[model samples]
Target: MKILIAIGSKDFSKPTLKLGMKVAQAFNAKTTIIDVGEKISEFSSQLVELAQDQLESWDFDAPGVDVLEWAFNYLSQNKLIDTKQTETGFPKNRLIDDGEGRKMVYLSGTACEDVNLILRNGDIIAELREEVQFGEYDVTILGKSRKRNMSHDLLQYINSSLLIVNDYEDQKFDKILLPLDYKDGMLKVAKYAIRVALALNVGIDIFTVFDKDKSQKKGSNYFSKIIKFIRRSGVQYSHEEKQGEIVEQIIKKADKNKIIVMKASDMSPIKRFLKGSIPLSVMNECDVPILIVK
Candidate 1:
């Protein structure tokens, strides 16, 4: 598995680092930590004076390779190169300069064999748009402060699964709230939930708000498939059917502390839920990290 951890220094969260590592270690997946440095809108007086004849300007990267190297070394020296899984790999490290007056630092490929790093300049969203889809990243984990979450074009438009890290605690993903509608993507969404559940050593509660008569049979088949998947995953889990309003039941059943996983596709239920509500109220109001699968 490949995991991307993005750090916007202004809203950087230490929990993001911890959660990234925990997930990586749990799945024995490679993790890339991205440090999106500050942007320079204008050239500095010293730089301008030094290169008076120069018309072109480029992004400046600070502590790019050196900083990431130090961090990777720290993790290795501390024997952090370990996970519970038998397989382990770290992606390769890369430093990139977009030459648009923005810098980045990438960390990866320490103990993980498949891990890779990437550094980009200019806007974070622009870089993501160029790389995330093209690279086929399985999951992207990002740190969002209380003041900010997934409100940008990059996050909103990405096709891969996204794990927004926020309002987190030290090991509190006791149960994952999976809101399903017995659709084709349910299994795909469950795949991600399995990864998270294993990573956190938590139980999976497969749930769906049904329309009673219309969904009972389909819901049964859905639960049967989900049960088979989770059993194969060798993780503790349970499936239940509820009759009520979908979003309301989901919100009421899921507290702020539980991890909620959902797919990003334009499913009918999800579309109805979002259009009936604000832009991302189900995500924003929950006050918890949401895993939106592709």
Candidate 2:
């Protein structure tokens, strides 16, 4: 698996980085930590290389380099990076511009498959979308944003599963709340929940919320298959069924203590764009971390 983690600042991104690395380690994923700096003007962009060389000579780092340096320190302190790589410290001078609007430095990882720190400058969503396409990442992890339409744009445009870390407390969460349906992609959602449950040493709450406007059936064969798969994975889990507005029920049940895992909407892109979807509503309403699997 390959994971992309987007971070903005040192002050607010610790929880995101902390949780993102944990998830990457859970899957043993090749991980990239990306910092999207403010976009430079055309003139500044042309002179960026010269500025970087001058900054390094003056014992100063270029824009976004400090964030990468901090990330490297966090990995080294946590023993996530290989000891040999940590000994030399953050390789600020080795950050290479690949001529693709990305500057990156690679490191060996101890807990994950590998680690790479990347710097880019552009609109956050645009840079992230391009990186996801270029890397073919399995998941993109980032902190919740207060910017309007941030969540909607990410869920709609990014071509990978997403984990939005909101109010993450490592010791506070106790279970993975997996909202299920008789949908076709539920098995994959269950698998993601199982991996996270094992990673956090938490149990699973397999919840099925029934829309009052739709069928009121108890469960289906597909739901049964999901339960069986969770059981076989050896993760402790409990199941429940409730009838109500799907989004409201999920937020009420979550109550800020569980990590939510659910499938992305299967509606056509146009319909989803116009009418929105269940997972998107939940993401906006809930305060807990959520993984929307695509």
Best by TM-score: 2
How well does each candidate superpose onto the true structure, as a TM-score?
0.72, 0.96
How accurate locally is residue 102 in candidate 1, as Cα lDDT from 0 to 100? 30
Query: Per-residue lDDT tens digits of candidate 1, residues 1-294?
Result: 767766554334456666766677666776766655444456574575356324323433243344444444445554564332113322222344446433343333434534444544455666665566656667777765344333434346655677777767856658888877766657888887888788787888877677544646454576578779889999887777789766666767677667888867564544534453322445655666777776
Candidate 2 lDDT tens digits, 74-190: 999999999988787888768999988789999989999889999999899999999999999999999999874999999999999999999798889999999998767788889
Candidate 1 lDDT score at position 279: 22
Alpha-carbon RMSD, each predicted model: 6.3, 1.4
Judged by whole-model lDDT over C-alpha atoms, candidate 2 comes out at: 0.92
lDDT of prediction 1? 0.61
Clashes of each: 10, 0
Model 1: residue 53 alpha-carbon error in angstroms: 16
